[model samples]
Target: MAFFAALHARMTGRKVGQDRFGNTYYESRKMMPVYNRYRRFVVTANGQDPTKVPAEWHCWLHHLTDAPLPEDKRLPWQKEHVPNLTGTRYAYRPKGHLAMGGQRQASGSDYEAWTP
Candidate 1:
C-alpha cells in the first residue's frame, strides 16, 4: 500500500524535505479540481503515526507556510522533534505512578485540607 502511495507521490508530487525520522514530504505538482489547490502529504518512514512529523514540517504539511523547510530554513534555537512516548516504555511516570511500582508518599505538615 505504501509502495503505491510512494509511486503516486513520485509521479505527481514534488518532493519536499525529509525530516530526521526519514518521513518524506510532498506537494502535488498540479492543483486538484476538488480542492482547487495542490494537495500536500507525508509518507511516514516507519509507522503511520502523525506525531512522527516534526513541527517545522507539520507547518508545511498543513499549508501553514507557502515555503517548505527546504526553502524556509529552521531556526537555530529549535530543538529536534521527538514523537510522543505515551503507551510506550519511555512514557513519563510521576513519582507515585502505578507503573513505577511506587506508592504516593503520605501528605505531611505542608498539606492543608480545604474548608467550606
Candidate 2:
C-alpha cells in the first residue's frame, strides 16, 4: 500500500478488525459522497498483496457479509488456510512444467497429423 493510502485510511477509516496474517480492515467512518454506502478497505501489514487476504476477510472486504466471520467459528472439516504461493519455491509444478524438467508422458489421446 502507498504511504498516502495508509495515511488516508488511518485518518478517515474506522478500524474493523485484524486478521491472523496481521492485515487490518477498515471502512469509511461516514457515508461516502457518491456511493452513499461507506467505503471499505484494508491496511495490509505486508505490501498490497491481494492473495494474502483470507476467505472470511475477503468476504467482509467485498461487503458480502456485514461483518467478518469469527476466526474460531471455522468447522472441523475445513483445512488450514494457505496463502497463494504462485511465485514462491513451494508453488505447484506439474509434470509438463519447465521447472519440473519439461517432460510429460504421452497420453493415449495424443493428436497425430493426417498425411493425405
> Which candidate tops lDDT?
2
Could you tell me which 10 consecutive residues in candidate 2 have the lowest summed lDDT? Answer: 1-10
Q: Per-residue lDDT of 1-116 in model 2, one digit per residue for the tens? A: 46777899999998899999988899999997898788999877878888888898999888899989889888989987787899999999998999999999999899999998
The candidate maximizing TM-score is 2
Look at candidate 2 and tell me the lDDT of residue 105: 93
lDDT of each: 0.83, 0.88
- lDDT of prediction 1: 0.83
Off by over 4 Å in 1: 70-77, 105-116
Error of 1 at 57 (Å): 0.7
RMSD of each: 4.5, 1.9
